[model samples]
Structures are given as C-alpha cells and as structure tokens.
Target chain A: MPLPGPLQDLVAEFQRLPGIGHKSAQRLGLHLMAQPVEAIERLASVLVSARRALSRCSVCHDLADGAICRICADPARDGGLLAVVSGTREVLALERTREFKGRYHVLGGLLSPLDGIGPEQLNIRTLLERLRDPALREVLLALEPTVEGEATTLYLSRLLVPMGLTCTRLASGLSAGAELDIVDEVTLARAFEGRRPIA
Target chain B: MLGGNAQGKTNLLEAVATLATAQPPFARKDAEVVRFGAKDAIIRSSLRRGGYPLRADLCFRTQGRRAAQIDGVPCRRMVDWLGKVTVVLFSRADLDLIQGSPQGRRQMLDRIIRQMAPLFHDEEARWSRLLVQRNALIRHILTGAATASQLEAWDEPFAVAAAAVSRRRAALVRSLAPRAERWLEVLSGGCEALGIGYKPGIPGGDESMSIEGPEFVASVLEALGKSRAQDLARGHATVGPHRDDWLARLDGRDAAGFASTGQRRSIVLALKLAERDLLREAVGEPPLLLLDDVLAELDPSRQEALLEAIGDGVQTFVTSTHLSDLHGAWRARADICQVAPGHIARPSVT
Candidate 1:
C-alpha cells in the first residue's frame, strides 16, 4: 500500500539531505510514524521555535536571537581584530576553539563565480563597514583550504591591501595528530612554509 | 588454441590492466571498453603480493560510469582504491611517448608519480577541479559577468595547486633521469645516454634546481600574473602545470627530433624499467608488469635486454598471438596460456 500523503512528503524531504537514499529516507519516515503523536508534536514545536528565535545578526551576519550577535554585543571582545568567515558554522567552529577574543564578520558564503556568487552577493559591504573603525587593526580570514576558500581569501586580501588594513588567513597545514608520513605533500609543504621559529 | 588478429589476446591483457588500475589502459572512455550488445563489462582478478591475497573488481557501464571494489569492499572514491594493485603496462602505444604530443609523456610521468605517491592522486584531482573552476571564471570575466578583481580569488589557489603538481613532477624527473640513463646504457649496450628533463610550465624555471613549498608557489603565482592578459583574452588558463612537459634527450640532443624508432623504443623501455624500480623501492613490492603484444615489435636484442631487466622479483604478464614470438627463456619460465576466441586454455609443456 502507498504511504499516506504526509508520510510520503516527509520521506521526500528526508531524501533531499546528502547521503540519504530512498531506502534510508523511507525507513526514517516509517520510524517517525511509529513514534507517539506527542513526539512529532514536540519536533514540530522545536523546529518552529528555533526558526522564530534565530535570525542573522545585523552586524556580523551570524545566527542570533537579537539584532546583534553575542560576540558583537560583548564589550570585552576586541574590535581591533576581526575574523572573517564563510558561514555561521565556521563561526561556531572558531567559537568552539576559544582561540580568538576578537569580533567576527560572516561573508555568508565564499565568492564562487561558477555558482553565480560574486562580491555583491556576499556580506562584503557590511564587512567593509565594520572595518571603518579606526581601532580595527587586523582582519583574519578563517576560510577552508579548498580552492573556493583560497580564491575568496585572495580576493578579500587584495581588496583589503589598498585600504591599508592588515589581512591574514588561517594557517593551512597538517592537522594535529596527523602523522607526517600520511600527510599530503601540499599540506606538508605548507606546514614547512608556515613553520614558526622557536627561541 | 592460438589465433590470428581480432582475437582476445590483447583484450585479456587489457582486462588485467583494468583490474589493476580500475581504468582501461587503451580506452579513452569507459563506454568504449564495453562490448557491443553488452550493457557493462566486469574485470575481476585474484592477486597475491608479499604473501597477502587481494581481489580487485571493476565494472564499466556503457553509460560512462565505473564501479570498483577492493577486497570485497566498495570503494567510495576511485582515488582511494587506485594504486592498491599497481601495474606497469607496456604496449605499442607507449611509442607515443616519443612520437606523440607532450600530453602522452606528461601522462606517463603522472602515472608513475601517482603510484609512488598515492597522495598525488588527490592533489591531481584538486588541481583538475581548480583548473576547471578557474577556466570557467575566466570565461565569466570575459563575458562581463564577473570583474577583474574576481580572478584574484582563483589565482592563489591555482598557483598553490599548480606548484604542488609541478614540484612533484620535477622531483620525479630528477629521480627517474639517472635511473633512466642507467637503464638506457644497459639496454643500448652503452651506446646511448638518455636524459629526462622536466620543463615546468612556469616561465624562467631553473631546470637544475629543486624548488618546493613557498618558493615554488611564489614563482607559479608570478607566472600566472604575467599571463593574465593573454589568458583573459583566451578565456582559459594558458599557464600552469597542465602545460608542463618532460623532454627526453638522447646524448644531450632532443630525442623526439633525432632518435630513431629503435632508440625511442629502447628509451621507453628504460623509462618503464626505471618506473618499476622506483615503485619497488617506494611500495616495498615490485609492481605487476603487463607487456601487451610488445615483444613482437622489439628486436631480439631489445627483447633480451627487457627480460634481463625484469629480473626475478617482478611478476610479468606478456600476451602474444604466437608463443614462438617470445625468447626461449620466456617460454621456459612462463606458464603458457593460449587465448582463442571467447576462451583461454593452459596447455601442458611439450
């Protein structure tokens, strides 16, 4: 027998996710159906409330409940240093490390010409606006090591250089705990390039 | 059971090569390898190396896709499974390395380098993707859909990836040149001195020096910047590792221009032998050698030199229409198998 319309719709939505095939989507849809009605109700409520609560922060374009994100709202964070990233996920990733005490500017996404994404499509205007602070000293690009990430970094650095702002990118090299023998030659070469001298 | 032309001798050898590399050595596309009236073709082999058993299965669909498995586990990516069963295929087409365009020689270098450094496959994939994306962006810039500033985004990464490829190619040539010289001297009875020179696409590259890491990346970026005007006009990347080539010089002269057919054959043989030696040293096991009806093309002396180079460690599979085509030593040491239409049989030694 054919699944009910809502169950079929749920299966289709599950299939839209990466790595979820028809069988897995169908199984997930069936599993959700077998659950108590209150469980589904709870899931729907949580999804709606999360959507309602979270909006992009006006300053950094990061997820926030208010107009400004917590990092931008915090008085202790250094406005002199701004870390630019591709998306909200990278903001969370950098936050997890607890490494930086500076503010952040999310570009929303990298500049991908083939995808019809350009400088105008990104949050670059706001980033430039944030950089208007005379106290802002350095702009750190925390982008991926992929081609798109590097390209975006290059583009931004070129733009920032004329503005007399210091621009830098996250160091790319072998990951911590990665064996030297297994690391790719490019990463190994980069590690050597970025090697720091000890006293 | 030996037959004439259009038989399955070369086909069987190609199947073995396919199993080893998950790619047919001769076919340009996967669909070309599939037989007429067949939707797909499967090549499976049970191999043993260093007392360890391995199985490789490759299926080529007519729809131009392939599926590969190693040891009964599906490979998520072809690059992950490639080089697991290393192979060195010697065919008549290898003559193209000398007589054909620079692409063939570059492919030879890339194949050997990929086997020695499996990570090279990943680097190569990234390089190709970057090249495509950069080219597309260039087109967009030409069409006024994008601005000149946008090119900067791709330039750095393209330079980095290009440097990675060119550095490895340069290193491979540096290592293989001497080995090739030694092999050629042996094969030519000390009559020829072969030199393999790496000519990176970067303008003003120092042929004698080895540059890696940041220095190489800087040179590539500079080259890209210099070529930006021309590339913008052409709507594609005209500079980088994709345009790199390795020159084969005999007695310090360009082998492509002056070497005879016989010398070219010997040079190719020497290069393959050098590849085998390097793979042995790198992987700790000699790679399988697939000689596809090449014995008939070589003279007896060259054939003898090839056999001497094979030595005892490497496992070799040679295919020929006639058993008499091979040297007596080959017949004596080889397990003779007769390949006929649609069938193969192992005949007892006479």
Candidate 2:
C-alpha cells in the first residue's frame, strides 16, 4: 500500500538532506510518525522559531538575532584584528579555541567559480566596508584548507593589500598528537615552512 | 576461460577492475584507454552486492575528462562513490611490481590502499594536483616568470599533502608486509621467507620511522626547502612521496636486485593474495578477483598453491588463451566462457 499524503511529504523533505537516501528518508518519516503528538508539535515549533529569529548581521554578515551580531557589538573584542571566514560554523569553531579575541566577518560562502559563486555573490562588499576603518590593521583568513578556500584567500589578500591592511591565513600543519610518519605531506610541508624558532 | 592473445581478454578484465575502482590500472590517463579514433568509451556494469542490485557507469573522453554514475545517479565526487564494490586484479604486468621501476610498485601500493581506505583516493588526488602545480611554479621560477616568494606560498600545502600520501603508503605497507610474507611462505612451501619494507623518499625516513607521523611531514618540508635550489636548476620539484618506493626482500636481500624470476613471480602472487585477505578483512566479505592470463605464468605447483589460496566462497574471473593452461579442477568446477572479436559467449554452467 502507498504511504499517506503527509507522510510521503515528510519522506520527500527528509530525502532533501545531503546524505539521506530514499530508504533512510522513509525510515526517518516512519520514526517521526511513531513519536508522541506533542513531541512532533514541539519540534515543528522550534524549527520555525529558530529560522524566524536568526538573521545575517549587518556589519559582519555572521548569523545574528538582530541588526548586529554580539561579537560586533562587544567592545572588549579587538576590532582591528578581523578574522574573515566562510560561514558561522567556522566562527563557532574558532571561538571554541578561544585563541583569538577578535571580531569575525563571515563571507556567507566561499568563492567557487564552477558553482557560479563569485566575489559578488558572497558578502564581500560588506567585508570591504568593515575594513575601511583605519583601526582595522590586520585581516586573518580563517577559511577551510581546501582549493576553493585557498583561491578565496588569495583573492581577498590581493584586495586587502591595496587597502594597506596586513593579510594572514590560518596556519595549516600537523595536528596536535598527529605522528610524523602518519602526517600528510602537505601539512608536513606547511608545518615546516611555518616553523618558528624557539627563543 | 578461453581466448586468443590480444582478443580483448585483458581489456575485459581491465574493464571490470575499472568498474570497482573508477580507474584503469594500466592507464595513467583515461584518454589512453579510449580506442584510437574513438572520441570516448563507456564502461557499465550491473553488480549485485549484499542482496542489492546496483549499476555503475564510467564515461571516459579525450583530454582526460571523465564522469561516473552509480545506480543512474551522477556522483558529484569520485571519493563519495568509490569502494561500493571491491576488486583485486592479477595481471602479467604485476611482475613489474617486483622487477620493474619503483613507480610501478608505488602504483601497486596505491591500488591496495585505495581499496583499504576509500578516502585515500581523495588524499592522493589532492596530493597529485598540488605536486603538479608546485612543479609548474618551480618551472616558472626557473624561467624568471615567477618569484621565489610565489614558490613559498605553495610549499606548505605541498608538504601537507605529501605527508598525507607518505603516511598512508607507509601504513599500507606495514599492514600488507606480514600478510604477504605469510602467503609467500605458503606459496613457496615454507622454503623461503619474504620481507616487505617501506622506503620513504624523504632523506631521513627509514623502515623504523613511521611514515605517516607528524615528524614525517616536518622532515619532508625541510627536505623540500633544501632541494629548492636544486629543483629550480632542474626546472621541477624533485623530492617527495611521488618518488617513494617499497622494497621487497627475499631472505633479507633486496628482491628487485637479487631475487630470481621465479622468486619475483612468487612475491607478486603473495602480494595479490595478501591484498585479497586484507580486502576481505576490511569489507567483511571477499572481493571479486580478476586474473588476466596470470595463471599461465605460474608452474603447476604454484598454480595449485594459487588455487588453494583462493579457497571457496569467492567470485573469481580468470582469462587465458586455453582451458588447458588452468588447473584441471578449475575446468570442472567453474563455468566456462569463450571470447572472440566483439563477442563474449555467456558462461556455460556445467
């Protein structure tokens, strides 16, 4: 027998996720159906509220609940040291380390020419606007270590140089606890080239 | 089971192997596999795995463009779709793994590693691209078209990617060495001991050091820096895992330089068996085995040993010029297929 209309719709929605296949989507839909009526209702309400409450920050373009994000509003954070990233997820990842007490400018997405994502498509203009402040001395590229990320970094670095701001990239090398024999060559080379002398 | 020489026997086996890995074992570029005067070629197969029927399609065009599809859905990334089907192929050229250039041995290691860890393909592809680009930058620097600082920008990523390739290659050799040794002993009737050692291309790397560890990347980076002047003179990047090799030893002697022809063949056979065993352990089921005119290369006793190694419950495809070249038992127990120009006779069930 065919699935009911609403259940079929739920399966179709689940299938739209990145890794979910048709079988898995069907299983997820059935699993959702088995949940208590109040639990389902609560999930739907939370989903709507989360989507409705979040908006892109006006200055940095990071996910914000208001016109400006908390980091941009915070005076304690270093406004001069701006870490440019691809998304809010990267901002959160950098935050977990607590290494940088600087503000972030999320590009919303990386520049992928093949995918039609160009400089104009991203939040690059807003980034340039934020950088116009003479107080912003350095721009740190906190992008993923990928070809696309590298291209975006290069493009942004060239743009930043004309503005007289120092451009830097996240140091890519061997991870902590990674062994010498198991480390990939690219990371190894990066670590070697990026090595600092011990005082 | 029976076909004349150069009658698509090897090509058929190559096609099956390509289906599983999305790469042609013998061709460095996909264009090399396409027929002369033909613009493109397609290899498609319907496979049944774990009670599920799946279809794989690979399209190869000139100038190195290719596409892959699984179950009628195009795969955006080759890494995401690889390893859905596992295979082990034994060809006459496998003899080169022991007697030929280090490049061939490296390719052998890569094939096995790709099956063991599908993600290794992505790492290898990234490393390959970085190496090519870095070498091109070196050439540009040599010609005064680019600056030294431009080379500096590429060094870090090159080292990182190289370290990954070296590490994976080292780990694969470590895992495969003992298994190959065991198989060699069985194949040689416990008369010979085989040793397999990973010889990294980095200057300080040895059998004792872990090739995939953090220090390996550091050392490789240092080596690349040291070789920059030399590389600039030569107009290419010279040092890294692309030049790395694995040493096959027979009773502690370098097999490539000292082992007899029969010994080399034995080593190749043992490595294939070890590969099959490792794949079985990795996927929890035996992989399909493709033997392309390789059984005829082995003597009767070695052939019997090969048959014994295959055991039971494994799907195997063996191509040869004659049924007489195969074991008598294989002739009786296995279904027979005949191949001719542009034709393949269906397997006749006994």
Candidate 3:
C-alpha cells in the first residue's frame, strides 16, 4: 500500500535533502512518524529557532548568531594576516584546526561564469573593503585548487595584490597523511619541483 | 605485420593508443577487448618522444576509470599523462569519415583536438557534465521544481565549455583544411581539391558560424534562451557544441553526397596524412601512425605515394594480411612480424 498523504510528503521532503535517497527517506520518515508528538514538536521548534538565530557575519560572511562572528570579535587574532576563503565552511574547518591565527574573509562562493556565479553574486565587495584595513599586510587565498577556485583567486590577486598587499596561497602537493606511493603524478611532480631544504 | 581476421594486429595498435587516448573506449575491461576472463588489463610502452626516452603505462579496471603512470609515477589527474604519447590511427572504421554518421567524424576530430590543445579533454569533459546538469535543471524549470532565474547557474558554465570546445574545433579545422587540400593534391597529382569546414552548432548573428571568445559564449547563452521552449518539450539540451560537425568538400562539391569509391579512399588517406602533419607541427614531434587494413583499400600507386610521403619520419605501424600488397622497397625496409590469435613472432630483420 502507498504511504498516507502527510507521510508521503515527509518522505519526499527527506528525499530532497542531499545524500538521502528514496530508501533512506522512507525509513527516516517512518522513524519520525513513530516519535512522540511532544518530542517531534520540540525537534521542529529547535530546527526553526536555530535557523532563525544564525546570521551571516557582517565582517567575514561566516555563520554568526549576532552582527559579528566570534573570530571577528576576538582581539587575539593576528590582524596583519587575513585568509580569504571561497566559503564560510572553510572558516569553520580552519577554526577547528586552531592553526591559522588570523581573521578570514569569506567570498561565500567563487567566480564560475558558466555556473551562473559571478563577482556580484559572491561576498566579493566585502572582501575588497576588508583589504582597506591598514593593519592587514597579507591576504592568504584559501581557495580550492579547482578551475573555478583558481580563476577566482587569480581575479582577486590581480585586483588586490597591486594595492601593496602581499598575497599567498595554500601549497599544493600530496595531502597530509597521504602515502608517497598513492600520491598522484602531477602532485608528485610539483612536490619534487617545490621541495624545500631541511636546515 | 601480417595477420588474418580476428588476429592480434589491431590489439598491438590499441595497446600503443591506450597510452595516448584521454578516454579509452574499452578502459572498463568489459567485453571483447579485454580477454573474456580477465579482471584488469595493462599496456606499457617505452619510446623516444621529443628525443627523450619516456615510459608510459595504462591500467584498465573492470568497473572504474582507467589509470596511467608516467615513468612509474601515478598520475593523480589523467590530464597530466594524456597527450604525452600521441598516435594517429587509420583503421577500417575510418572509412566512416566519408560514409558513416556525423558522430564518427566528431570522435576523430575530438581525438585530434584532445591531443593538440592538451586541455581540450578537460574542457570537453566539463562541457559534457554541464550538459547533463543543465538538461536536468531545464526539466526542473519546466516542471515548476525550479525558477527560470536558476537556469543561469548551469547555462553560464555550459556556455564556457561549449565555447572552448567549438573554438578549438574551429581552429583545428581551419588549419586542417589547407593541409588536407595540399596533401590531397599531392596524392591525386593536382587533380583533386579538398575543403574541410567546421559547423558550430551555436548561432553567431551571421552566415559564418565561427566560435570565438566572449561573444561566442554570449551567443550560446542566447541560443539556449531561444531554445528553452524546444528544450523543455524534449526535456534536454538542444543547443551547444556537443552537436558540432565538419563537412568535407571534394572539388568544391559535397564529397559525401557524390564521390567515387576510389576518390573516397583518397580523401580518407589525405585526411589521415594531414592529421599526422598537423600533430607533428603542433607537438614538434611526429606521432605514431597505426594503419590497419587501410592499405588494401588504396590503389597501388596511392600506396606508393603514402609510403614515400611517410619516409620513416615518424614511428609507423602497418598491419596487412596479404604479403603481395606490400612490394619491393617498402617490404625490404620494414621489419616484418607474423601475428596469430594469441601470439606474435618477429619473423625476419627485413
């Protein structure tokens, strides 16, 4: 027998989510239906409130619950160094490492003309304004090494580097924890070319 | 090389070709090409290219994409290894360039472009992916699942890929046409004239359909906009370079429409020779030529012309079943090999 109207709609909603296929969607919908009414009510409230509380940080465009994200408000970060990322996800990822002691500027996306993403569509205007902070001496392009990412980085560098700012990028080679045997030839070739001396 | 039907003559050429082809048609070791019971197949070659000895390896798995290693180093991206070993092939299937569907001609043209541009494969691959995505997005729009404004998300990328692919193809045909004309003249002793023209599928506001830069991409986007109704009805893309083709004109007339059998053979050979010349000029090194049963189709005089033109400039591999077809000077200079179903023997040091 087919699912009832509401349950079928629930399954369809689940299916629309990324990575959840038809089978998973059906299972999840049935499980949700089995939950207590109060528990389901609380879950829905949490989802809505969490979404409502969060906002894009005015400074960096990272996820924030207020006008400024914790990173932008933090006084301890190295103001001289600013890392420009294509998305706020990178900001969270880098923060988890606690290695980069600098503030960040999120473009929200990259410039991919074919994909209908252009300079105007991204958080690029804020990125340019952030560069005017005299304390910031260097901008690190923390973009993926993909064609669109490269194009965006190149576009930014051409626009910003001439303004007397030192620009840098993440080194591309074999990823950390990746074995030498499994490293790809292009990366291997680059690794060999960019090999550093052990002092 | 001498081999009967279904022998390993073409296999040797395919093995060499595997190292060069960006997308090996049989890379997924499934039917006829990979032996009936084999899980995987690998082809390895070491040869002098650009006067430097290079080692290339191609690995084909039953269920995954093919992998390659150059000098024993695994390629993370095949683009690094593609075009490193180029080959110009002439097989019985090549007759389709004049007689078969447009798809065959496009495949042959794309292979040449892939080798010449080096990045053409990546661009074309991207185009193919965007085509699928854009088609789905179009479907979504037609069904009210997505807004028309969201179409730009896929159209922009699709246009980029379409422009790049068609531009390279146009450039290749532009350069190839004159060279093929000259080669055809040489083969026919100035009796035949050839004209190759690339027909870009995009509208460019003129009779001439040449794919240029930004304007070409804008044209594609516009064409996509115009074709939205038709595309919606079909539930797929109906515009772009994916539908590009080239036409051959013999003596200022459509060759495919009314060319003699002998004249058609000469056209194919002229096209093949022109490809070899174009590749050599582009790469600064002659590519390996694989001729499989093509000699039998050409007349005796044309055969001599081909051999004389080749003159050992590039490494050439020829496979023939009839020994009588190959004569004195050519037979004397070539290293002969006997090919059977499962084995090959170096018979003589001719």
Chain A accuracy as TM-score for every candidate: 0.90, 0.90, 0.91
Q: Which stretches of candidate 2 lie over 4 Å from their true place?
A: A1-134, A142-144, A148-199, B63-65, B347-350
TM-score of candidate 3 on Cα atoms, chains taken together: 0.69
lDDT of 2 by residue, B1-350 (tens): 57898778888888989887788888988889999999998998998888789898999998655898998999877765677888999988897788798888898888878777776877887787777777766666676656666555566667888888888888888889999999999988899999999888877667887665577777887888898888888877788887788898999898989999999999999999999999999888899999989888988888888888899989999998877788786776677888888678877533
Model 3 residue B292 lDDT?
79
Off by over 4 Å in 1: A1-10, A31-54, A98-100, A161-168, A172-199, B1-8, B15-24, B27-45, B51-84, B203-216, B340-343, B348-350
Fnat for every candidate: 0.67, 0.00, 0.00
lDDT of each: 0.84, 0.84, 0.80
Worst 10 residues of 3 chain B by lDDT: B25-34
Residue B149 Cα positional deviation in candidate 2, in Å, after optimal superposition: 3.8
lDDT of 1 at B327: 80
Predicted structure 1: clash tally: 1
TM-score sort, best first? 1, 2, 3
Q: Is the docking of candidate 3 incorrect, acceptable, medium or high quality?
A: incorrect
Each prediction's total of clashing residue pairs, residues at least 3 apart in sequence or on different chains, is 1, 29, 3
lDDT of 3 by residue, A1-199 (tens): 9999999999999999989989999999999999999989999999999999999998998889999999899999999999999777788788899899999988888765345565668888888888889998889999986656765777677778799899999888777898998775556756886888999
